[model samples]
Target: MFKNLNQKNNDSIRVEKDSIGKKEIAADSYYGINTIRAQENFNISRQNIHPELVKAISMIKKAAALSNFELGLLDEIKKNAILEACDEMIDSNLAEKLELDAFQGGAGTSTNMMVNEVIANRALEIMGMQKGDYDIIHPNDDVNKGQSTNDVYPTALRIAVLKLLGPLTKSIAKLQEVLQVKEEEFSSIIKLGRTQLQDAVPITLGQEFSAYAEAVNRDRWRLYKITDRLKKINLGGTAIGTGLNTSHSYIFKIAKHLRNFTSLSLSHSENMIDITQNMDIFVEVSGLLKAASVNLNKIASDLRLLASGPTGGIGEIKLPAVQAGSSIMPGKVNPVICEMINQLSIEIICSDQAITMAARDGQLELNAFSPIIAQKLLNMLEMMKKAIDKFNNKCVKDIEVNSDKCKQILDNSLAIITSLVPYIGYEQASDLAKEAVNQDKKLIDFIKEKDIISNSKLDKILKLENMTSPGNNLSE
Candidate 1:
């Protein structure tokens, strides 16, 4: 149904020419071109391979090279070449010359091929040898020795994500810091609290800000908890979970070397069967991302509402103006970063859905879609990390509360009746609240007219501190 998307017509595209096996090879549509075609051919969704997969690829190569170097599978000279090539890929210089898409069906076989080609070509350049000189340093026998895409790709993804957990924790910590500051700043400001988008009672603005802080803190802790689980990899499992052709010593040896190289707390799974079958860790990470998204989305939405207007709406708060608000309207500033963060939340939420769907697709022995699941989950993590960084550094840290606006709304609020409970009693206060709302009169005016409390008493209770702290025990 979607093959038409890959159709090539009369239009010409520039091509590079090279030699392969004594024959001229045209770089027209063969090298990594199948991936690009598949991308177009399978327009089932706009979803592509996650960017985090690149980090995963780099980690795997590093792990493999370190293992090989320690176990004498390769000499220092070859290992150095491999390391240099892998580093180049990490720096993303090879991407300009290569035209591969990040997605493929053979459980990242295409990605593996792309990696092999990049390393081989770069190694050739390093050795002063021509590109594709397999005999000098073959892509398969040398670079991919004793490894399969199945083990290597997933292991790389795990390591990459585990590495990212550190920065993500820091981002969450930064956001928590911003939230803490807001909590202190707004501690004495009371406003009507909403339960289901309807007014319920009064709550301190500080309380709401503290809630956001707790949420980010929880997510940071959860991500840290899962980091150790991701450290357990399937590198020694080989191709079909049998460890075929691999000696018993090489299994643990490779994992140990990889651990030292990455400087990460790494371990090997006890059961290859369970490792290949259960993707619970992947699902767990995805679920955590979803939870984080919920908190962030709610926070973003609330910020937008709180910072709604300076003239018309409930403009109790003000967000930093990072960009011009309108193309036509002059002197306007917009809340674009908040909007972007909200959209990122939605995308991360959708990635969780993809993870769930992919996890459920696993069968008896192996999950064919583990690669995609790993890719998507890691992508969500990175995206969330980036969003949190931007929101905290750019938006949250610079937010300002409109003091005069908040005071104006609070002074005119009938919602202040709850604070009068100790003085006027609940029933009388409730009655006065309803009367004030009906007449659209300020609570101060209502209190003064009804003589429920003396003017001096009302003034004392109406103080911000008194409203925020109901246990002051001052008599009316």
Candidate 2:
């Protein structure tokens, strides 16, 4: 969205120094020297870290500033200035000012520093000072007080993920409800059920939709079940969960303030080392996402087959004609929504492999690879939710049931003979079904020629309700 933002840093530059050396930063930009260094080094992934993450870390900076002020560690003016800057960062597009690529080294230290630098510089503007004037509102001494990148980055990541799950869970529930609505809408339409791609029995289109509804409902609950674990976080573990170079009292103080501030039921971890070093929670999340994608892929594949052809294929259901399918063939319309969903599910499943590998590669102290995990998991959630919303609105809601086509397929299938078991007995039904195939006639017509059963009784046995559902009144 900020692609056209003024990126001409070379036009007017300001000098800033770091531990290693000095570098020139954009004079008009809020980002500082550490950001410039990372911006120059890692340009691999797309520009800008996830904005929600930037907001999360900004919230952390605000929380840290507030807590330090309450503890008498920071003066009120700098605290208020930092707080105002954080509000601006959260509410406005200030995150676009930080121009480093998402994939970077240092276990997200660069990302954390980028946020600190931008917030500090913005706070300097609010405090009537120059951008790089660290003496007034230093990024490290003021904005990032009592916090390390090891603590800030992962904690902010947890907060961002929790925020993202809100929209995604709603998307899942809406999808389930829409599927249920379709289930009820198509409840009485009978169609052939197949196993191994061969006719096996008769089932209603509603029954298939109901199964999809149940699958999606399970997925929603599976994600909801993980929410409590996601709330548990390691905030005070400054470096390696030891709280080294951090105020012990500030540990619990930050947790209390954040819970009241965000209203998210956030908790401080008793075993901060476990939470910091082991990122199994995201792995579990990736697995649930994979399961949901599998269900979606199955539904999309079924739609692809059911909406196969208008003349030469099953044609039992018709998808919404969103756009012209073929460039040359004039009236051709395709199930592009289903096709899009199919491809999206495949992308999600493959991305899950990357998250799992990143989770496993964490060293003894910290998961440096969580930056990739954060990028991958957040992207999956954002993309999946939006796509699922489009699918529900564009594809599922306007779906039309080809009732005539469904009845024709059921009427012509040899599986219809299975309905005659109660009236004619199994052996006789099977034999007549085979004989009907050999005679190249529908089972009903073949039954009439052989006088296997009276028309009245046959009609009752093959009635739409009796074949599609259960408990026929007919008996031999």
For TM-score, the strongest prediction is: 2
**After superposition, candidate 1 runs with Cα above 4 Å error:** 1-52, 65-80, 95-98, 197-200, 420-428, 448-464, 473-476
lDDT of 2 at 474: 53
lDDT of each residue in 1-476, candidate 1, tens digit only: 11121225525342322232133222222232334444444445455555456545655675677667777887787788888877766665443344344444666666665666557556666777755566777676677776777677777778777777788889998899889999998887777666676555566778889999999999888988888788877776777666775666777777776676677877877776566656778888889988988989999999888888767777878898888889899878777888988898889888888888887887886777776686677677788889898999889988887777766666665666666887768998888888888988877777789886777877777655665454653653
Residue pairs with colliding backbones in model 2 are none
CA-only RMSD, every prediction? 5.8, 2.3
Model 2 scores a C-alpha lDDT of 0.86
Range of the 10 consecutive residues with the lowest summed lDDT in candidate 2: 1-10
> TM-score of every model?
0.83, 0.95
lDDT of 1 at 37: 41
